[model samples]
Target chain A: MLEARNLSVRYGSLTILDNVSFAVGDKQWVMIVGPNGAGKSTVVNAVSRGAPYTGQILLDGKDIRKYKSTELARKIGVLAQDTPVGYSFSVEEVVGLGRYAYSGGMLSSKSSGDAEFVERALELTGLKELRRQSILTLSGGEKQRTFLAQVLAQDPELLILDEPTNHLDLVFQKQTFALIKNWIEETGRSVISVVHDLSLAKAYGTHALLMHRGRLVASGEIPDVLTRENLTSVYDMDVHDWMRKMLSQWEDGQSGNLPV
Target chain B: MKKREGFSLVTYLLFTLAVLVTLIFCVCAGSVSVPVKETVSLIWRAILGAELPQSTAKAIILNVRLPRVICVGFVGASLSICGAAMQGLLRNPLADGTTLGVSSGASIGAILAIAFGVSIPGIEGGGTVVMAIVFAFLALMIILSLAYKLDYTLSTNTIILIGVIFTMFAGSIISLLVTFAGDHVKSIMFWTMGSLSGSSYGNAVTIAAAFAVCAAVLLSCARELNAFAISEDNARNIGVNVRRVKLIVLIAVSALIGVSVSIGGTIGFVGLVIPHMTRMITGPNHKKLLPASIFAGAVFLMLADLVSRVILSPLELPIGVVTSFIGSITFVYIFYSSRKGRG
Candidate 1:
């Protein structure tokens, strides 16, 4: 479980996140939804202990800042919105980097179990076939999968994902959420994800948090917080009509052909 | 898996062998060429504590060639390691000591010593190296502080621009010192342009000791460097202390460049070209690339030193000049080829 209290982040005079608070329960998938620049990514970064925040973030009843980096890493795996890699590491090598903290930052220090974890992650993410390929040569979708596999290889108690499905195809997008859902069921672990796909969030999330203009507008059960009213006000648009229209079109068997 | 293992093993052996062969050849083929067999026997005898058969050859090997060869090897290794670390730290393949103005700043320090006759006690090879190291560290601190003040957004363009400006600033100061030196300008210029022929045992030992310490620190953090090659934010998420890693890398790399320039002057291409070439073979994993670049750089620079001394016989070419010529050609070729691949 994770809890963020009165968290605020600022860059010079600009306040990116102000007094935001949220809690994720055991095995819960908390999907954070917001318009552009609503500080969705900032919240994830704050939890990762990368960005300095004014307030406290507690993981399993302990302040996240109190934990050593390697300790935090063993418990939390993060897939940030933009993971920019410059090198041409092989897919296997990239995935193996997930074991860095555990392996004491040396490949020679890795145990047999770490290799198994990497292989398992590669297989789960459908990247086993491309394990030997250069990561620089991967397509957008393949690269995303590779990074996701890396996160999986960390084998953490919690997963923090910001836009985890951005570059994924429809099939892998579904597969990714399914994999996370399976992880929750199997290990009772939690996931905090910032996603733009409202439909997927509504379908898969156990809880939802709506943010608007650096403020948390709503937070509760997914169906409760993702109501038409909260959706309309947070986005500053009429979403009820759009939802009804889309639902009716889907019911009429005409939505499947819609282009991505 | 087995094939990959074999490939890396072969690469390791090839570079190790190349460095060894090049070292022997460099020691043998200077202005006073020694026969290969004779050179080997002399080295063997020296190692065994036996008196060398020929006194003149012994003097050449022990006094002149051996020290120069050792200095060149360590300097080459240090420069390439600095290059690899800088590239990873900045996440820009083009980053090197020369581009970052560390070398120019060092040259200014050395040239100032030549101009004003400043010397530090206990430092071997005169005050040139001592001053060079001081100025190199100053330049690094300035660049680091500038980047930090700008909120640490060290974009590739920003870093390159800053490096270029710093280089020009250092260059002007060097020019001022050179103008003031008058008759000593030739010596100052030669030092700046890089020449290993002037190296003595004291200079070699100084560089070798500093290089060993710096290389150990850098190689120990190779995994951290690999993480840094990606974005700093990602490295942090993966449990790396980005700020700490950056600081360590900066210090280690600066020390490497300072010691190297102290011994070999601002040898241009060993740092810039060797890492790029080594990465092509090692696939950018710093664990392998770091050591590979060190050996490859040692071999390449020793060979260049050999060519500089041997070609034109008695007249020595500035080692930097030869490296720059080879480096520029190779750089252009790499650039165009990579661009063509992209297109």
Candidate 2:
């Protein structure tokens, strides 16, 4: 289980996240949905210990601050929004880097177990064919999957993804979310994702946290929290009728794409 | 795939043969052409323990040509390896040993040693070696400490900036010392121009030892260096203590550069051009790149020294000048080709 207590983050004098509190229990799929500049990334960064915050974050009932960087990496895998490209490492080599925290040091040899895990990760992410290909040659969607493979290789207790579907096509987006869902079901691991697609969040997430201007407007079970009233209030859009229509379609295993 | 690999191997073999032929041609073409027969016989006698008459041929081959050849090889290898390592560490293709101020720092120490008339204890002709190591290590420490104090991230630009500042300081000191040592100006000038004429057996041994140690240390850290080439943050995340690795590499490379410069004077371009050339043939994987740089550097310098001697006959120009000229031309060619390829 992971929990953030009274989390607040400020950049200079500007408060980015104001006293937000949330928690995710084991095997839960929690989705954070907000409009642009809604501090969703900040909350994810704060939980991953990438950004400083005023409140405490606890993982498995222990303060995350007590853990070292590698220790934290071992427990929680974070895939940031922007994956910078510079290195010339092969796809396999980059994926293998996910086991870095467990590798001890540069000169230390990888264990047989670690290698197996890496192979499995490549297999799961469907990167086996592109293992030896240079990462620079990969397409955008393939690159995202490569990073996803790396996160899978980490095998963290909690996976934190910030816009994992960005830069992905519809097929890739569906494949990626389905893969995440399957992973959670198989491993019984928890996940907290910052998403922009309301339909995706409503489709796969078990819990939802809605935010606006860095303030948590609503949080509960997905069906309870994702109401037409809540969506219209936070987004300042006339999405009440559209959401009700989508909700009914969603109940019938259909995703009604609302016009923006 | 097998055919492709075989073709690459064959190409490498042809390249090696060509370099060997060039090396022999270089050795045989110097002023006062010792006949090819005499040169071969002299080398055979030395190797086979045959008693040859004490001729100038023996002296020329053993003392002058051999030392110069060995010095050229050692200095070239040292500079290229340092260049490759620095480029990888800083993740900048343009970072070379000189850009890091190592050559200038060593030059300052060499000049100071000459100016102060300091001699090594017990070991004759060890002054340059000791001074080179000392000044190189000192300058490296200063740069590293300054970077650390400023909480500056290790980047190519930051390192280059520090190197530029140190180069200015070292050059000023060198100028001041040269101004004061009017009588020794010729010696200082010779040292500055960088010649292989005064290389001795002791200097050769010292330089060879330094190169071997540095190469071994760097080879063992090849994987770490590759990891660093990606990104420091990534390197750290991958279980490498990035700061410590950078420090160790800096100290080791500076020492090699220092010792090489002390023995052969401030030779340039070998470090910058050799590694770049090596990378062009081989990919950026440091495992293969490091060894290729070493061999290519040695071959490049040997040919450069030979040309410097044979090009002007008895009025030998500085090997350093020849190397710089050759290096600049090759660099221009590479720059042009890379730009054209990109376009």
Model 2 misplaced regions, further than 4 Å: A1-78, A83-89, A96-104, A108-110, A113-119, A128-132, A154-158, A164-171, A190-192, A206-260, B1-29, B32-53, B116-173, B190-193, B330-343
Q: Please provide, for model 1 over B1-343, each residue's C-alpha lDDT reduced to its tens digit, 9 standing for 90 to 100.
A: 2122213677778877888888888899878888888888888888899866668988898778988998899899899989998888887776888877888888877788778888767654668777878888888888767766765757655666788899888878778878889898888887678998888888888888888898999988887888888667767777777778888888888877877887788898678899999898788888888898899888888888988988888988989999999988876776576556556
Q: Write the per-residue lDDT of candidate 1 for residues A1-260, one digit (tens) a residue.
A: 78899999999999999999989988899999988999998998889887788999998999998987878888999987657667788888888878777866433456458888888888877787899898878877778778778888888889999887786676656667777777778778889999887777776789999998889999989889888899998888977556545433212222111111
Residue lDDT tens for model 2, A1-260: 89899999998999999999999998999999988888999998788766789988989889987876667778888776656555466787777767866866445556457778788888877888898888767878888788788888888889988997786766666777777888898899999999887877887899999999999999989988888788989889966566545543334322221111
Model 1 TM-score is 0.92
DockQ values of all predictions = 0.55, 0.25
What candidate 1 gets wrong by more than 4 Å, as runs, is: A105-108, A241-260, B1-15, B113-118, B144-153, B182-184, B337-343
TM-score of each: 0.92, 0.77
- Number of backbone-clashing residue pairs for each candidate, in the order shown: 0, 0
Q: What is the alpha-carbon lDDT of model 1 when measured against the actual structure?
A: 0.81
Native contact share for candidate 1:
0.63
Instruction: Evaluate model 2: give its TM-score.
Output: 0.77
- Model 1 lDDT at residue B73: 90
